[model samples]
Target: MSIKSFAAKIFAGYIRKKIDNWASRPVEVQEKVFRKLIKKGRSTKFGKDHDFLNISNHKEFAEKVPVRDYEELRFYVDKMVAGEPDILWPGKPLYYAKTSGTTSGAKYIPLTRDSMPTHIEAARNAILCYIAETGNSRFVDGKMIFLQGSPEMEEKNGVKLGRLSGIVAHYVPAYLQRNRLPSWETNCIEDWESKVDAIVEETRNENMTVISGIPSWVQMYFENLKARTGKPVGELFPNFNLFIYGGVNYEPYRAKFENLIGRKVDSIELFPASEGFFAFQDKQNEKGMLLQLNSGIFYEFIKADEFFEEKPKRLTIGEVETGVNYVLIISSTAGLWAYNIGDTVQFTSLSPYRVIVSGRIKHFISAFGEHVIAKEVEEAMQEATSSTGARITEFSVAPQITPEGDELPYHEWFIEFEKEPENMDVFRDVLDKTLQEQNSYYFDLIEGKILQKLKISTMPANGFQDYMRSIGKLGGQNKLPRLSNDRKIAEQLEKIKKQ
Candidate 1:
């Protein structure tokens, strides 16, 4: 390894120690860390000046910064596309990571060399820890496959050559570069749609040991692969050993993924966003994901119940609590200060600071006049599954409001599961009861019968992938969107309905 690569590892180890120490403390100790966070918020320039951009400092400032949706970032990204310097950050960003925001409206998120190191450190450190935990240094000698997004895309200001995954590929340490799946497209492709066929073709015959990408997309890619090879996926790529996934949950497609490949492969979850990489599964127990908070960014959390309307109690690395879900806010080297990434997670145990991501707070339905958050949905789903002895592989709940004459006024679920319920009527009743007991809104809806019926659409095995594939969004960073609240989301639903 070069000096930089060697140094990165050493720095990662040091940061890991701090995280472990903080995670292991008592609840009181964790509370103390929040006090320190308030002090730091006052000192940082990025934390204080950019009112709209910075939110983590909400506790210190009486007038909290406004939450910006993706459109607000679009103008800044357009400026970056125009080759403008120091628009969003203090210095010039390297380029943008083109991503599908809320629509087909592709967004080019600004990324600078200074900002990128955080992503590198967080991701690389997670990889190193995984190797240490699993004793799987085979990555050092074996080839790895990354199911990346479009290698390129057109920016809002008309500049091309914007691809976050490709840019990351460009900056990775050289020693590891040789072990990657060979792709000249990684260097040349500038628009995402232009290279889909080539990317699919590149993996046809390789000694692939690891596969990394979003669950839905990876499933779609292999489904396509099976069509091309005219053989079971196992026969086409027998050497594949592991599946590394992030950006979305993998529970829904787990059984299908194993069955398709015809071998038991290690599965890992990575929690990353457009801002930077945040956490990864430490080990394979389905326990808690280890966070790389200090590696690349400054991290804090707000109480789950504390919306922006209320004063959010921010927690530092040391000041987190177990069982209570908190919202994540981060300040990164890229200059995002107190940025709320809209994720809700809770600590399982502190010793190592293992956390379980509950889900997105913004992605829940609050119809029937009761506020139903993502955490409640997850718990109710779990309860329903346990009671029925049925495992839900994948499920999504869309909240809908109907007119007075309409029958169902609350919500609907499009669920994909491995086995059909033995007694359909009993299964539905059990699930509805579980939700009603777990959440007040659900219970109210059932008691009043205001939401007349709950519709459950059972999908074919691996059906979620088909949904994602139809939209051309299949890779890491492309999530199975939880609650489709926007108007366009309805259109997407109609497409699925037609399909």
Candidate 2:
């Protein structure tokens, strides 16, 4: 083995041992994090206003600080943005991660001096864990490409502001600096199409071994590469074997990706956000990402079904159970207290506190009392495609509450297929059956005749891409929702289909 690979193996072993030590004592580590966060929070303006000084434990803390989404917490965030000190965390934030907000125009999530390193560390440890498990540190010596946003920053009250990925780009370890692909000028291109073209040109002939990004954007890059070289990505970059991704589940895009690469590659899934780096896949054979219990964030879970109740019980790490979906609330060193990040997660393993990002709390279809989540739909799609030998490029689900003629309202699946199923009726049946098996409410609805079996509408080539482009969110950390309760997205897909 090369010198770099030999050193990587030693480092990976050390990191893996450290991770195992903490993962074994999940609740104890979390309690320590809680105490540290509370101590720091006591000094902030929000801490003072919320009576953080008097809070002694989780119960008191919960009572003192109600869970607040971005809109509810804007009062304090606005102060932080306006150059106020100690409004949320302590002192001014080091940076503000700018992201699109649903009701609020743009959210500026603070990244404090204490909290920023956790993001970088979590990402680094994920790779180390993979290397330790698989004994595959040779990828360390090869070129790596992280398709991401521009590193360009705008300042707000002395705080650097940019997309989370852009901010992270600045923190890539020194050792990997020479190995990282796409020159800085190419990454700074404002337009995603141009950026991808530049990236393709720059990295097409390089010895790329690891590529990281959201699956959709990476798919675009792969397509562009194939178009240019007339060869599958794996053939062009023989050393490429590790695929690291975050932001969205990669299962739905797996088939198309395998086809583009002409082979299967091992992948690491990450559960990260602007608020904090929460979890990363620590085991290649495991079912879920290892929850970052020792990170500088204290976690709270409200059962997703009861999330909207007047007062839902917030459970700590010690009180959670497997197979239950919960709204992930967090109080972090970043200065967010009882903050709702809007994502829902389910524990797949409690011994080491591993979790799967189940879906977004707001992104579900319950128009007919059948609460179907993103996980169920994605899994159903996976099962149907696997069974039928079909390859899908992208898809989204929405409730069709109104249907013409005598047909009952049903779920409308807008799907973009790379290889259409030979028997589409059979494909649709398998999709519907798999969803019903996973979600009992939907099963009940189907059995009671309240809703009909789901229908599929094949999207034209690049239909989803066109929709995203139209909305000005075509690339760089933006992903379409897997499902929506309302018809806003469904109606738009209809227009794209007709076109």
Candidate 3:
């Protein structure tokens, strides 16, 4: 590694020490520290310039800065794209993380230098906590795997276009960049046809120690790993020690991953988003996730009912309660004041500020732990239908829970298309297989109790799209809803099934 990269790791280690010192404190001390940090956040340069920072004190600030959603951030993004920073902070942002939207259409989440440290620090602490809990100290020694987007830069000389992941690669610590298993530029699975297959090939025989990234992608890798290697993951990489996953729940995907590896793997849940890393799983079981609040952003939580019923009421770390879900809001140096990230979480304990991701406030699915929030389910369906070599034009998923008499709840997938899916049965099987593999709870529930079927319907090619358009949701920032809470959606789907 270059001297600069080595220096970066040292700097990160210093930051980790400080995090440990603070985190090691009693709950009361942590709360006191949190208050001091909030006050400091209010006095920071970003707070001074923005009107949103006008609260008289931290207490008042927490009370007044209502919880916000992505829609609120979209307004700022619009201004940022137009070259207006809105005085929320100093300096221009680097780029936006292009993520799929839930209630809205596609979203371009802004990422800036000042705001990135939280993500960096949180990720680092997550590693530290994992080490603390697992007592396996060989973090830097083994091959690590990250299933993620291509790191290809978007544009070089304004000519060839690439991916955003590559751009962020430049900012990673040099040591990490070198140790990263898949070389960013050389190993991207750009050709849509060979993506999963290629990923499986890339991971084979690497003597991997750590694994990370989105659950869906990891599931794909494991499935293909089993196919190509003829051995489950545990047999293939006996040295694998830790599973670091985020971007979705680990519970639903846990059993299958363990089964693939053929052994128990220590795991950590991370809460990194395009914007920043908010919190990470605590080292102790039953201790809620620990928020890296002191790193880069100031956090505020809105009570569950208040967040839903009226303008959200923000609570500082001191006022937070145990076992109740709250909407997460952050004010970051990256120029966002009072930004509401869509996730909802519940605190399990206070001393360490441990929390669990409960659900999304809106536009997210609550069933199957598929992480099938509005956007992911849409993207997966689109990808599957397009790649299946079938003429499928539309689809939906309604989560159903059977009464207590039944063993498990069923997830009814509604499909509508002109022609029967070319390899209809195979496609259905693929869909079921993929969902179960991607979502652990779905897999476990299915194996244990729920015997859901892949329900298919034949409609005109545009039938589903036409219905979405009729609902006045065809255009900008909208999508046909999937993973509905009410059984009415399934009932409607059944009508289409019978048609």
Candidate 4:
């Protein structure tokens, strides 16, 4: 056996044993984790300010630390950025991961010595778990092409700063580094188009076994490779069998990715963020990812429906029920306390807890009294593609304001296509029909004459990327939103088209 495959076998075996032991008592494990986090951080500035010493249990802990978003925590984070050591954690963070999509454009989330290794371990376990379940390790024997940001990080207060993926890329297990490619210099190129070309040129004939990246960027790479070689990706890398992806929902680009690869391959999904690595797809039979209970994070859930209320009820790991939409609150070793990262999720299992992402708190559309989320948009988009045999490259939706003289507001979807459908009217109809079926408020609005059928506008192939680049959010961990309550994103797209 090849050395790489031999190493994978050992890694996979160890992960299986750990998974079996951890999966047995999910609640108990989480309680222990919370305790460890509290004890370890009780003396930090944030802990002292929040009265962490007085908190002995989850209830007191919850009462002491109210839920907060980045804005609320900005005071402490700003202090850290100015090099105030031990403001949040025990010492200064090793680096910061620059994230986007806030009112403030970009946010620098700390990457601490205590927290960075957790990110690495979660990724390692995600791969090993897949191998343990599928008995497929051949992919590990060859190189993996990770489409990540440039590792040419900037420094803020003596701490390195870059995209989270680039920082993690710098610290993956030494053994796996031997099987990974496209040199660091090429990855450091700031121009995405040039970087993609460099990646395509370097790895075209290599023994590629796995591909890991955001779906859209991967699509761009595949498009470039196909144009250069006049062949599908499967022909270029016959041994490739695994695709690991995250940072965006894969549903809209599912058919396009398959068409590019020329076959179905094993896929493992992860819910990773600058804040913490929360979940991963561990079982093929399961509907959602297993929530990592012992990952140095203390989790709280507030029902999404009540998230904006005067006082929403908070649920802990033991009290959480399946099928409830909850806004996840995390307090982790990264020095964040009861921080809301904006993503909402629904639990699918409780015994061995697992969850599926529902949508972003800020990205949902509720302008017309019809609450539509990323999950609904994605499912509707899938049905539309399947019924019409069309393929979408990227899409975003916004509520079209009702005219001053009219009571009906409709949805306008801006889409870029890989393969356009023969019948545009049918494609639009199926998409509207699926949304009506998925969301009751949306269905009521359409049926009661409160809303009109959704409209679809075709965008130029590169329109979305153009807008993203304009906003300095192209590539790396950046992702497009599925739905917006306002026309902010739609208006930007229109301007890009005009340009």
Candidate 5:
């Protein structure tokens, strides 16, 4: 056996043993870790202000610190960015993960020396756990290309500034670095198209076995590779067996990915965010992701209906029930205190505490009280694609509720297609029918003549790309909002189409 294979076997065993105790009593593990987090940050300004010293449990912690959105927490984050020590967490942050938050601009989130592990360790162990479960160590023996952001971190106020993916890429472990494709120079190319071209050239002949990135970028890479070399991706890299994806839902793009790959490959879903590395698909056969409980982040959940209220109810792991959409709140060692990250998640299993992302609190369409979310839209699209022989590259939806009073309001969709549906009218009907079945409010709106059926506009080629680039949010972890309550994004799409 190869030395690398031997090392992977040992590492997999160690990881499995390390995490076995965690699944047995998840609530206990989180409770114990929450106390540790409170104690660790008790000396910071945020800790003292929130009475962390007097708080020893979840109830006490929630009572003292109010749940805050990014706008409210931006005060402390601003101080940290201005080079203030102990403003939120103890000492200055090593770097800030630049991301698009609630505001129109970028939000700089802190990544402290102590809290970096919450990102790094969780990602590493996610892979290790997968290997332990599947006994697939051959992935470690070949090159794996992470189609991530540029690793060229810029300095702001004497601290590094980059996207979360770029920050993680910077710290790619030395062992994996030996098997990783695309040099740092190629990764640093700011123009995404140019970088993708460089990546295609670099990884074309490599012994690639594992690929990781957002599903859209990975698809683009595969498409380009096929263009450059007249062969299917599976034929080029016969050993490529794993595809890791996160950031956005992969359901709508799955068909396109499979077509490009020319076969079914194992894929893992991750729920990592700028706030923390939250959850990952640990067991290949499991339907839901295993939440990361002992990762220095204390989690709280509030039902989506209650989350927007003046006094929201916060629930711990012990209180969450399966199949209900709950807004996620976190108090992390990375200096966030009872921060609401605006993500909506649903628990699938309470015994081992497995969950999956439902939607974003702000990204849903409920202008007319339909209360439609990302999960609803994505699943509906998946069904539509399956039934209509179509493939979606990207799509977004908005409520057209203020249409001519004589006519009923309807849902408007702007779609960029990899392969257009054989019959567009049928595809739209399938989506509308599925959504009506899934949501009572939407059905009521349709039945009572309050709204008409869905309206889908097949966008010009690369419509989404042009829109993103025009707004300077073109690449590197930037994802298009899939659903919105207003016509702002739809109007923007029209402008992009005209241009």
Candidate 6:
């Protein structure tokens, strides 16, 4: 190993020990984090407005500070954007992560000086944890590529504004700076297609090892690389072994990715957002990511099923249980208080608090009182593909309430296939049966003649990509929702579906 790799191994071992120390006492660490956040929050305008002075514990905190989404929190956020100090966090924010909001047009999530380091540390420790566990530090000596947004930033009221990934690009550690690709100019390209082409030209022949990005965008890069060089990505970059990703589940895309790379590679899943870096896969054999209990963020969980109910009970980390889906709420050093990020997660391990992102709270179908989530659909698809030896490129699920004929209302699955299943009927049956088995309400609806078996609508090649492009969200942290309650995305898919 090179000197740098040797040093990394030693550092990784130290970091792993530190992680274990905190992870061992998850509840205690979280309590300490909660205290610190509450203490700091008392100084902010929001804190005072919510009567933070008398709040002594999680219960009081929840009672005083109602969970608010971005739109609900915009009053304070707007003040922060207008250069007001102490509106949310102390002083002005260091940066504003600009993201396209669902209801609100544009959201500027603050990145305070105190909270910024946690993001950097969590990302670094994710790799360090991998190195320590697998004893694979040599990849650190090879080139690493993060398919992400431009590093360029715009200033609004003296605060730097850009995508979260772009802001993070500025903080790439000095040690890995030498090994990171593509060139700054290539990353700065506004168009994703042009950027991917430039990236391919810049790093096609280089010794790349660690590649990280959303799976869909990386799939596009892999396809472009194959098109140019007539070789699988693995053959082109022999050293590449680790694939790190977040934003969406990778299971549905796993078969397609394996086919593109021509081999199976280990991957790390991260749960990161503009609000906070919540978790990361710590072990190769583990089912879920290790929740960051001590990351200067206080976490609360409300059972997803009861999330819509009035005055739903909120549970702290110590109160959460395994296998139960809960909507994740966070109050962080970044000044977000009792903020709902809209993500639902299920705990796989309660001892160290490991969780998998289950789905979005809003992204589910309940058109017929048969609520179905993204995780269920993705799991069903995974099982069907595994059984049929089919490879899916992309897919989305929506409730089809009104059929053209006498057919009963059913779930419509829009699928883009990398390799179509030999038996379409069998594939559809497996999907429907699997979904019914997982969701009891859906099972009742189907059995009671209220809904028919789910139907599959195959899309033409690049159909999903075309839909994303048409909506002006083709790349850079944008993700196609896996499940939708309405037909907005489904209708768009229909327009581009193969005849």
Task: Identify the candidate with maximal lDDT.
Answer: 2
Give the residue spans of candidate 4 off by over 4 A.
403-407
Query: For residues 115-209, what per-residue lDDT tens digits would candidate 1 score against the true structure?
Result: 67867766666666665556555545556777675454444443345556766776667877786764756436533334445666777777677
User: Residue 372 in candidate 5 has what lDDT?
Assistant: 96
- Candidate 2 overall lDDT versus native: 0.94
- As for TM-score, the candidate ahead, 5 or 6, is 6
Q: Can you give the TM-score per candidate against the true fold? A: 0.76, 0.99, 0.67, 0.97, 0.97, 0.99
Q: Which 10-residue window in model 6 sums to the lowest lDDT?
A: 490-499
Candidate 2 lDDT by residue in tens digits, 1-499: 9999999999999999999999999878988999999999898899999998898899999998999999999999999999999999989999999999888689999999999999999999999999999999999999999999999999988999999999999999899999998888998998999999999999999999999999999999999999999999999999999999999989988998999999999999999899999999999999999999888999999999999999999999999999999999999999999999999999999888899999999999999988899999999999999999899989999998989998999999999999999999999999999999999999999999999999999998899999999999999689999999999999999988888
Give candidate 1 regions above 4 Å deviation: 1-89, 103-108, 153-161, 186-200, 234-236, 308-311, 373-395, 403-410, 416-440, 447-453, 458-477, 485-492
Candidate 5: give its CA RMSD in angstroms.
Answer: 1.6
Which of 3 and 6 is the better model by TM-score?
A: 6
Local error of candidate 4 at 71, Å? 1.3
Model 2, backbone clash pairs (residues 3+ apart or across chains), number: 0
Over the stretch 1-499, how does candidate 4's per-residue lDDT look in tens digits?
7776777878798987887688788778878988888887787889889888888888898788889999899999999999998888988999999887467867889989888888998888988888888878888778898888877789998999988888988886777788888788888888888888999998998999999898988998999999999999988899988888987888788899889989877788899999999999888778889898878888999998899998788788889998777899998989888999999998898868889998998789999788888888999999999888899999999998954575477899999998999999999999999999889999999999888999888999889999889887777557888889999899999888777
Error of 1 at 467 (Å): 5.9
Worst 10 residues of 2 by lDDT: 490-499
lDDT for 379 (candidate 4): 91
Model 5, 1-499: lDDT tens digits are: 6788778878988987877788777888888888888888899888888888999888888789999887888788888898889988889998899887556578898888878877998888888888888878888889999888888788988999988888988788898899997898998898998988999999998999999988877877888999999888998999999998888888899898888889999988899988899999888988778898888888999999777778878999889999899999998888888888888999988878889898999999898899999999999999999988799889999988777758778999899988998888999999999999889999999999888999998888888878888887777477888899899989999888787
Alpha carbon lDDT of residue 145, candidate 6?
97
Q: Compute the lDDT for candidate 6.
A: 0.93
lDDT of predicted model 5: 0.87
